[model samples]
Target: MSALATVHVVVPARNEERLIGRCLDALATSRALLLAERPTLAVRVTVVLDGCVDGTAAVVRRAPGVDAVHVTELSAGGARAAGVARARDLEPDLDRGRTWVACTDADSVVPAEWLVGQVLAAEQGAVCRVGAVHPELGPAERLLHLGWLARHSHAEGHPHVYGANLGFSLAAYEHVGGFAPLACGEDVDLVQRIRAAGLAVVSTGDDPVRTSARRSSRVRGGFADYLTALAVDLARAT
Candidate 1:
């Protein structure tokens, strides 16, 4: 079992003002739950407002106990990297091996057990833990949502890497040189690198994070875009 200590949550957002507040609210709940379970554990949440020309920063400012970092770039990978760096700056003495870094999107709402599950995974000797996500689709998009569920697996040992519900030890993150500056697919890239480094990556379906199912995406080739593509394919097959 690994000696766990602090847990840092990094959220990357771009023009997500409409949904970021809800995301922060969910994270606060998760943070509080984790703290209640482990009285001495430390949990930090940081939101990286990347190239936002909207009210995203305002929402983050109103959020208590949440740190906001503003940047002029639209890269999700870069924003995640910047957020983690800010976490390090705030706590200069964080133990790389004992500290956990969790990444999620501003359009996602994590469950109350999100942080607790990651901390438990770390305590069980996992260097990285990849969880699942369920998109919050509207009633009109019921067919699309059902199609997506039919094609995707929501079980343990599933082959899915989502930044919206991913966590890793700071030591393993540093060893892999952190997330690359990619506009999209950065989560998959980071997980691939971790696996190549012979690190133990645990995949679980427990407590999937709720994410936006909007067809329009802030970043190209992101989850929204993927869903849109799936919708198109489903239409063609009909």
Candidate 2:
């Protein structure tokens, strides 16, 4: 039996018109699966459009069962924090301890069991749940994918943290002062703070989300940059 009453999902987008649609579609499926499994739980998906100057907003508008917030901060951390605040505004009396805050990137496609897994982990007394991510690479990027897999681990206690697949109790999030306003590495920073505060953090390889492996990233030092760096290293070794 789960003790959680509500779950809020936050996605931050910046000129991701080409991929945000797929991301939301996957999220809709996950949301449906979660609701079907736990009929009493409340689920909300909010997409934060940060400094978008393209068709991204239109794509978000076409998606059903999702709320959108506009911000010009151009910071992933700021967008995420704004999304959470919007969720809180919608549920004025939300119980922080009993509420779960899940985060994912606008360019990632989450598995149908993503939300269910996080909810289950939260119910089991996990203050934070960090899942895994598998990059969606084209045939041309096979080497990059291979290199990534060779350097990454997919185990129960894997040492990986991604905003594309992270969830935490609202109580724990607030206690850590929430996410900082940074351009990148916000997910890692939040997790570090949570651990430093002595919260029960759960790292699982199950329900890995699929994110784009594009070289051009919206923010510096993001997954795209990491993948590019990996490719460079591979090139140097070859």
Candidate 3:
């Protein structure tokens, strides 16, 4: 088996029992995408249950086609690192050249054509495919999504990579030292590092990934609150 055939989607989850099931369904959908794109590609899902005192593990276990690993540690940074390591270890043949590691959050749902679209972007010469992630929307979730879209729209000039749905060639990830050990904004940090290394980053805006807004809502101060939060984050980063 070639390294590229061992593509794995690593999801770092923390107290996401309510959303994990939907995320898993999305993973299954993504696998179908892989099969459609390359019938022989072997796709795997790795869910790292981090600091989950809830039934997150059970949810993953019940979900079809998922490899769940429970890690009591609360650090998402560490959990993701461990998950990626486990994925690579499972398929020893997956060295830097042909393998790829995709990262997504357990609270997010992937598009049905997510994997196929990503693979196509990579094969089309994108070193790191920065995919867009939209907050799940509805009357109940409308405010949150609108807030997210508004704040993120300013980032239009640069391809925004959501920690919930991003991918990188194993070689590219290793070259850039993987995700930064930050409490948050790891996705943006990783993308910046990739570009700093002279790698071309492209986004799949045409096929966005949908992620639950449940977690975001917990901290969101309604629409106004979200805008304030975004301002603070951007200001701090700047």
Candidate 4:
């Protein structure tokens, strides 16, 4: 049907064999919610393995409803660009104007309603949809991350979407040049560009995406250290 809208989910994975499966599983669950709420919404998941040495491609193929794309060079931004391009090419009939794209890291697990929520926002005329990234941690670690979230959550002023849970219309994505070929901070940079171009970025905290807190643990710096690292990199842009 011409009236049907399409939404593609792209995940850039690098050495995430252990967690990519969970992310794909969450996407399958998201597909269910989208189908129930927006029957006219077509859904597809593209998992881009960013030069992973592990069995990331195998894991994605095994996932119930994922189309895996293995990118030989391991660059997050580059992988995302390739993935989005592949999505558009694979589904030639997709309406670039009405089609929406959702991006998340392979290490993150989206909520069941993630896609549905983003679609709803897009339908409401939101050009850029930003969702919260909650830490998937043990009780103590979660408490620490929560405290960090509370303290830094107010940083949500404009174009402050995390790559872990971001969505935009195909038109909007292309308008922002998709993901740039940068080594880091491409997400923050892209969102900032979106805002600079006068597009609205709506944050939907209700739809939380779960991400590992291992980076924080590895820092021995804990949540503060992790936040400091990202903040040092993204604070100016945010």
Model 4, stretches more than 4 Å misplaced? 1-4, 154-159, 216-238
Which residue ranges in model 3 land beyond 4 Å of their true spot? 1-3, 140-147, 154-157, 215-238
lDDT of each: 0.90, 0.92, 0.73, 0.76
> For all candidates, what are the clash counts?
0, 0, 1, 0
lDDT of each residue in 87-178, candidate 1, tens digit only: 78998987888889998888899999999999988998889999999989889888898898998797889999999999999999899999
Best by lDDT: 2
**Against the true structure, what is each candidate's TM-score?**
0.96, 0.97, 0.83, 0.85
Q: Model 1, 56: alpha-carbon shift in Å?
A: 1.3
Cand. 2 Cα-lDDT: 0.92
User: What would the per-residue lDDT of candidate 4 be over residues 1-238, giving only the tens digit for each residue?
Assistant: 1233788888988778888888888888889978987786778888887777888878887887688777787455788888888777888877788788899887789988888888878877788887777766576554455555655463344324577888887887888788887666667777778878988678767677888766533214333357556545544544
**After superposition, which runs of candidate 2 have C-alpha atoms over 4 Å from their true positions?**
none
lDDT of 2 by residue, 38-114 (tens): 99999999999988999999999999989998899557888889988987899899899899999999889999999
Off-target runs (Cα >4 Å) in candidate 1 are none
Q: 76-97, model 3: which lDDT tens digit per residue?
A: 5677777888777777766666
Q: Candidate 1 at 221: error in angstroms?
A: 1.6
